[model samples]
Target: MDVSWVDGERRRVTRICDALRIRIEGVARAMTSDQSARTLSAESADVPDGAYSGDIEAVLITEEQIQQRIAELAESVAARYADAEDDLVLVGVLKGAIMFMTDFARALPIPSQMEFMAVSSYGSSTSTSGVVRILKDLDRDIAGRDVLIVEDIIDSGLTLSWLMKNLATRHPRSLQVCTLLRKPEAVRNIVEVADVGFDIPNDFVVGYGLDYAERYRDLPYIGRLRPAVYER
Candidate 1:
């Protein structure tokens, strides 16, 4: 007998449910948007000058700056060897050049192969000893191949000069250099570099695969090591 009222009641309840569902959905969207904004802020936050346990005196180059330079270096190198017959061979100076080599390879527009050689002129010392030694040698012969020597940093140019002479014996079709960082001393020295990412000061820097006694290589950005850390 009251079926009409029941229908009205049902419609009212349905409307309430729809309204509640809409409100819930709106709250969820708002929460999601807020979370995304927070994530973006965290990612874009500026890295502090003394971010690395205060051991780094100052940041020489930020991570973003390093990456951008690397990309530009890669493009320049690729353009030079764009018409090469064989894939470019990247001869990375090991331990130090590992990071630059990998990143440069990935950024290169052309296909390339990798080889590493470990040469040392500075054995835990801040300055080069002026004597270069080969701690490791290339794994494969590079005869007749276009070779690019990837270096992390060149300070005095002793190690790079020695490496160039050594690699020259292999008779690569073409040999050139690409270094991520270089010092004023390196600039004065006569080693011809095909590409340089950044020409930094003569200060002792560690990070981005450059290190002082193997400590600061893991840092994302290049930084000057405090004199206290290595001077004593």
Candidate 2:
């Protein structure tokens, strides 16, 4: 066997192991949240029954809530970059960040250009490998432009950390991050986020372009996934 091929296989196995561990941890945490949600009385509960396709234990953030926050974030972003000499550019991470980027862009009062980059750390897995590969590059040069990165969620913070550093080499006038969700406990690296919509608990959530195995992106609201859904 070729030594290089054997090395590749070993790395593949390592990723699979890491993904499984993260999935198990997520399910355990979700189950706890599910139990807590059950304690809430029906009248006090916000999420109605049958609201999601999967076994959603609780609605973490509703669509109404997200929109309201997005409006506020837009105001802040617009004000900060209002006096900029150059046109603002919004860089959206592909697949996951599409929903947030579109909504955030529309909410901004200032004129801006949009660009996208597709990156992958975990192919079909639930966890980050701390290594990133740029599947697609930006179409336009960002040099001297004010760049804002719109993201759906910041989990471990590793991928975003890598991204910010990579983009810095392009010499943008300014670079900042605006993410819809962030998990403080799960952050392995310190990423300075300019605008954050929600600081949610460390739980595996799906909806609004975030998914588990590429499902549940169409959901309007964010919710904790039922442990059984992923365990299966």
RMSD of 1: 26.3
Q: What ranges in model 1 sit over 4 Å off? A: 1-51
Clashes of each: 0, 0
Clashing pairs in 2: none
lDDT of 1 by residue, 87-191 (tens): 999999989998889989999999999998888787556767878888889889887898888999888888887787667656677677788887778766666
lDDT of 2 by residue, 1-232 (tens): 8999999998778656544543344344333421211111232125566646447777888888789888988998899899999778999998999998999999999999999999887744567787799999999888778888899988887777678767766757677778888886434345657677777777789888998888888888888888888888
RMSD (CA, Å), each prediction:
26.3, 11.9
Task: List the global CA lDDT of all models.
Answer: 0.76, 0.76
